[model samples]
Target: MPFRAQPLRLVPVLAALLCTAPAAAQMDHAPARCTAPAGLPAPMASWRNPLALKAGADRKAAARAILTPGRTVTLALLPTPKVAYPVRPAKPGDSVSHGGLASFTVKEAGTWRVALGSGAWVDVISDGQAATSIAHGHGPDCTGIRKMVDYDLKPGRYTLQIAANGEDSLTLLVTRLP
Candidate 1:
């Protein structure tokens, strides 16, 4: 008689295979833990230690803090209604939101980046007009930055307006692209 296949004998073999499947799958698809980049870019590295300042309610108050390129500042914002943007934000926040104004002088004309730790509207204003934005994107993963906006700026004083932020404080950085 020909040898017959035995179902009972295969049960133990199937059970062993099933038990190891999950472990093998996990080894293949396990997510990697998030860690800072091996070496952070200059602008991103500045976020590690941020200077604290109060956001200005209006043009007058904005003079208190001078935003510098290549550095990060944490601004304490005010109620949206209290902020008087030199030029209206392209995306205006509701009254319940928070906002503020700060000023920065660009000694060199170039493409400058404005990075924010929250989803806030940023408008760079010079001579009472809004500078056109060149680019918009999210910051690097694992960094607290949520948004980044770029503008082509000329050497001069500009108003950095923060609007429509959900929180009363925001971390901001201005860095020039080489």
Candidate 2:
């Protein structure tokens, strides 16, 4: 006779497992901004990310919290990014005024979102890749952040550039537990 699984005994186990994701894919629980200083680029054609810290959490204790809509976390986006910059400013949006940038540290590897809020275009640079970008005349927020793009980030900083077209007035809030 084949062994049968017990559903009743597996409810808690399933819940626990479902409650946590992998390290690299766990950024889904990290904060919005980094643990470094925040910044705002001068409206130009190109730009570089700043924040140079890791996810808001360290390994072992707690996982880094990912930025989710309606759940804001405190963090930073250093204008002095880890990568080299040609001094190229970011693509200013249409209505970005009183704007700036914010970064989030990586506690562990996990999926996360740098969802750009109200602006012409928000550019997200992770691990030196311009992965997620919100185009012009588009909404400020961008979801469906891909894996390896915003998750399982190395113990380092990630940049989220939120700006508008004319005068950057976009507000970036960094949210994280702890």
Candidate 3:
């Protein structure tokens, strides 16, 4: 009689291979938006995001968090932003106030580093409060340097409002030290 194949023996091998897959390769998740506001744009055409910095956890942490560093956050601003802060005197192609909004969630509470490419301005809003870094002359990356902002944040949801100085594209990156 010819040798018969043992189909049952292969089940264990297949199971072992499936279980050993990396966590990242097992699932595909979407990266949180970094250029657009969280839910809806607050249903306001001229709403400027608020900026605030606090020492510890607060009421804002109650909301769910949603951003992951695995994906890249890149976006283009509208021809004319609904809200513009006009940080300086308006120049041609410079609205100052026109900016895009992005929302993210903080999985762990810690000091987070937020870096913006092309010297874009950012307004951090939490619990309806806002705060910004004050610079009299120009942004950290205004002169072709990357701008970085650091803040102590609690685990919660956050809205990042950003506007390009003059360019049409902006890149926002967020990370925390291991």
Best candidate, TM-score: 1
**Steric clash pairs (candidate 1):** none
Ranking by lDDT: 1, 3, 2
Report the C-alpha lDDT of model 1 over 20-137, residue by residue, as the tens digit.
9999999987544576544457756888689998899888888776888888999899999888888888777998999999989999989999999999999988888998999999
Which tens-of-lDDT digit does each residue in 53-118 have in candidate 3? Answer: 111112232122223432334545544344333232122235442345556777887766665555
Q: Rank candidates, TM-score, best first.
A: 1, 3, 2
Candidate 2 structure, TM-score to reference: 0.32
lDDT for each of the candidates? 0.87, 0.36, 0.47
Error of model 1, residue 70, in angstroms: 1.1
Question: TM-score for each prediction?
Answer: 0.78, 0.32, 0.47
Residue 15 accuracy (lDDT) in model 2: 81
Winning model by lDDT: 1
lDDT of 3 at 137: 29
The sequence of per-residue lDDT tens digits that candidate 2 reaches over residues 36-97 is: 43342222101122222222212111124233322333233222232132122375422223
Clashes of each: 0, 66, 14
- Shift of residue 52 alpha carbon in model 3, Å: 27
